[model samples]
Target: MSGETPLRVAFIGCGNIATRQHGPAFQTIPGVTIVAGCDLLPERAQAFTARFGGRPYTDLTTMLAAEQPDIVVVCTREDQHVEPTLAALEAGAHVLCEKIMAHTLAGGQAMLMAARRTSRLLGINYNYRFFPPLVTLKRLLTEGALGEIAFLSVTAHAFCFHHALDLLRWLGGEVVALTGQVSVAADPQVHYPVRCPDFVYVPSRAASVVVRFASGALGTLTATRYEHLTTRLLRLEVAGARGRLVVDGLTLDDIVGRLTRWPEGQEIPTGAGPERGFALSFQQADRAFVARVRGAETPAATGEDGYAVLLLERALVLAQTTGRTIALPSLTPVAEVGR
Candidate 1:
């Protein structure tokens, strides 16, 4: 800990996510200490601690109890997310979890309920907005640079639909109703795991959804998993009344640093800056979480936001399975006011 009592950060699952994204990023965030790391396996946590300079443990409860971290990052599989997140939040730690939040709406809401019960911050890793181009796009929309958005078209192949859904919600607004296709796998009993290794992997391996935003603008999202494709594939077309914005790919240089994609005549917003790494976006996320802890700003993505994304994900699957246009549901039984 350094500089006026740093926030102590603990990692619940120090696998690839903790090793790659959250670990290094947390180490660099000002006033944040990489206090402890845990994994179901000792070797994984040990490796994280060895590089990231944290104490390592095998069990989450023991680590949280002994170290009393200020923030817990749940980098476990989606199915494994709720337990550790709930445990840490109940222990009064702010939590940041990898997205698609959870596999089901109830699972996501359970995590939200834990945060609500404890009044701790629960944030999601919806890091797409951290891209400088999209940041600028968000700014343009906010400042009325694009006027009222007309429609959006997106094609993405991600491990899950959460990020794509977040982009749609971010570019447009709340979804009213949607219809499309969702499937776990082309082969029954062969739904492949993308990156997740530890837990039972259950996610739509392919998805296509047509979103009707509450703003009355419409959008289409297509997502699928290419188990063999080495490169990321993403494209966004945002059409507004005044002008149009299109974004391609999701990498540091490919997405944010590539400035040539800026709308025909206008420069990127004067103050829009690149958030260096897609990994670096985790740092930006930590900065926001720390800011929230300091009462200076809000966390990047709230529990409710993550819950809403899950709703859209589940709804999309439901729409395809049931073959009906499904109206979106409230995040909870009723909205959690002022969340």
Candidate 2:
């Protein structure tokens, strides 16, 4: 919007994530304002207002009606996302929803359907896509510095299944079919040392997923919750026909021992800066939504993308449960969730 006024934004679900991540991130954008926030807990809402600079409310309906914000940030729990999101979209506001889109496929579908019916933009917060270093990796792969990505493998730690899924979709083309192996730990209370607030841990103790992309590339995404290995959890290896991107330690492997520079534009990270690197993607995601509202940049992962992630998550879970290979976007029908 070529310096047009800031878009008025309101947030729902003023919990740990809303107070910590999204609120601060939204403030960093040029044409966005975190005008108000709503939560069931008044104290939490007040805390969010104090920390994030927003008017507090205890009810979403009243907040939406009174504020009439241009954008609504839905930071509710994975299972609680649909209602508030649908209400926001139905009220003629664009939405940016948190990850794991929903707890069930039907829940995701409901949000997707509402956004489609309302014709309002519905963005999913796939924050890892906004990581500066990962952005550098994406540019390299897209520019063919890594020629024809062939095999992708992720040896990641706990609570980032969605990140791995989105990375696969970004680097490899559409997934055609997949088979996976999940190893559940003997103890039910096992926990990983993952520190991010936005990541909702999947119940599986350990997972190994094999995905086949339509572009004919085969990849594996694995997560291990072994106690000692959770701190450094984001190791990735994207081997292409030419070069490769190995992000465990942020190095490029192309048969040569190492490639230092990020092919001219690697060092200079664009968009939001590093002060919020812990939640870098959320800041960038907020920026993207505001840009779209102002007719500036196009958003990548929309509600459909969120639905796809939920489907992927569900497919993996179903795979683990039924001991069978699952096709993309296909699962046994079930009763609607959170109805």
Superposed on all Cα atoms, the candidates' RMSDs to the truth, in angstroms, are 3.8, 5.6
**Candidate 1 wrongly placed segments (more than 4 Å):** 1-5, 183-190, 194-205, 226-232, 257-277, 330-339
The model with the greatest lDDT is 1
After superposition, candidate 2 runs with Cα above 4 Å error: 191-203, 227-230, 250-276, 298-300, 329-339
TM-score of each: 0.87, 0.84
lDDT of 1 by residue, 137-250 (tens): 666677876678888887776453457788888778788888887666666554655433321223447667798999999999776765322345466778888777776545
**Candidate 1, backbone clash total:** 0
- Poorest 10 consecutive residues by lDDT, candidate 2: 250-259
Q: Give model 2's TM-score versus the native structure.
A: 0.84
Tens digit of per-residue lDDT, candidate 2, span 209-281: 8998888889898876662332454666778766566664421111111223323323333343424335556
Candidate 2 residue 102 Cα shift, in angstroms, is 0.8
**Alpha-carbon deviation at 320 in model 2, angstroms:** 2.2
